[model samples]
Target: MFFGCEGVCLSFGGRRILDKVNCSAEPGRINGLVGPNGAGKTSLFEVMSGRYTPEQGSVVLDGEDLTRLPFHNRARAGLARTFQSPVVPSTLTVGEAFRAARKSHRPYLSKHDAEWAARLVHLEVSWETPAASLGTFDRRKLLLACLVMRRPRVLLMDEPASGLINAEIDELDLIMRRLVDEYAMAVILIEHRLELLAAVADDCVVLDLGRVIATGDPLTVFDDPAVREAYFETPDA
Candidate 1:
């Protein structure tokens, strides 16, 4: 497995958030994590990327133990995650953000390598446009581009399709699928966009109140009445 979490558990204040969660992903596959609000999907990603250390659990990457590593160390170890709300530099252009991250992460990249990362994320900006001027969709796209520049073996994305228009969402979906196919990278997606999730993910893991409620193919899990009752039903019911 490229990435796996063993017996992971996390708590905030007096409340236990993730409860002995176990998840694994290998190359050439996308894993989807779906749940209602406060289900701990973002927390799990935090643990996996070494942002928030779990109270009890182990994070393994490509068979190496990564439990105690700091976030930057984890990034150097080939783990990268994109945020639900990405912050872009006000003075930098889209291409500049990619260049800066590449320089920071790899540092030894030649001009050609930098250009490759830019192309990978579909950023075609000139070196002059400030990143602050880009629209919300492009800002998110630039963030993804930065993640790609990190050259991570396993990539985690949180709600990447949220708030995007139909055309932009379709474009993002195509980029993700293409990345997986062409690079053989492993992806873990936490997205509320069920339609896009079903289209991209090979398997799905559903969480409820911080526990695994179901795990299976996307269609099977989505169709299950238990999931519908726990997550999809109107609260008025």
Candidate 2:
């Protein structure tokens, strides 16, 4: 099965944020979405996640159309996403956050689900700890646990490795690979951190200025001259 966008287009105030971008994530595969700042990677994610309807194109999952579905419906349709920043409710406790995520897909959170999610993300805090009380790295892990608790068909992760130590990043990378293989789901990861993306992604898609500039093997795509030019200042305009 696969999930992807075809000919997606989005603009704000007459300025294009995404322009006819196309990419796919196959089951049990990690598709890395990378670009320099203002590259519209996140905007492309918004179009795929149904946060913003695209001006043109479709969001497809296993051959079904999801372009018009709202965020909740998309989640119900087996879509889950994590933001560039953690979005766990500050008032909710560690366990509550996990429970809240599961509540959308199930009436009650099972012990197995809780343990699986907590362990998957290497969650360490007590169930009683307020989510806000955790540090940035731990907080990100907690939010990741919340999303993974649901076992969505398509996972959209935005900059999940930000603010993590080398060890934690390594753990995150391993966990992501395990999750994809275990669940057989399509995962699109938008990350600025090249090392992490290179380590986790099975394939790579490069987006620059709202357009897909390159797509293929992770190492090859990153090494493309266009990609280098986007990151490093070139003498020629």
Candidate 3:
């Protein structure tokens, strides 16, 4: 397994969220996390990235325990994640962000490596364009490119399709597919858009009210009666 979470649980205040949510991500596979709003998908992503420690269970990466590692350590240990909201620095250019990530990790790498990474993510823009000037979709792509340059073994993405137009969503999907195919990275994508998720994910894990409701092929998960009911049925009085 590239990344594994077993028996993970988290709580805030008096309520429990993400109860024993077990998941495994393997290289070259995109695992989709799908659920109704407030189902704890983002919380699980946070836990995987070490933003929040789980109250119980373990996070293992490549057969080693990573439950207690800090965010940067986890990142250096071949883990990368994209935020639900893009956090690219406004002062830097898109190219600079990618270059900085490589420099931070492997300061001695030649300039060719940095250029290669930007090209890998389809970032052919001028190096001098300030990041603040990028459109929403380009900013998101830049963040992805920065993460990919690190060559992480696993990636955690939160709602990658949100705020993107249909055409841009399609473009982003193609980029993600290329990453998995070319880099063999394990990807965990948290998405509310079912159609896009179904198109990309090989398997889907459905969470409802912070628990695993179902796990299987995307078609099965989407067609499941429980999934539909949880997402659409009227609540019982």
lDDT of each: 0.85, 0.85, 0.86
Clashing pairs for predicted structure model 2, backbone only = none
Give the root-mean-square deviation of each candidate in angstroms.
Answer: 1.4, 1.8, 1.8
Model 3 global lDDT (CA atoms, 0 to 1)? 0.86
Local accuracy of candidate 2 as per-residue lDDT tens digits, 19-69: 898989988999999888899988888888888999998999888899999
Model 2 alpha-carbon drift over 4 Å, by segment: 105-107, 232-237
Pick by TM-score: which candidate is best?
1
lDDT by residue (61-147, candidate 1, tens digit) is 988999999989988888778889867998887667656776785455555765776688777777577889877777887788777
Q: Extract clashing residue pairs from model 1.
A: none
Error of 3 at 8 (Å): 0.5
Q: Can you write out model 3's per-residue Cα lDDT over 76-110, one digit (the tens) per residue?
A: 89999998998788889766776676677644455
State TM-scores per candidate: 0.95, 0.94, 0.94
The candidates, ranked best first by TM-score, are 1, 3, 2
How far is 8's C-alpha from truth in model 2 (Å)? 0.4
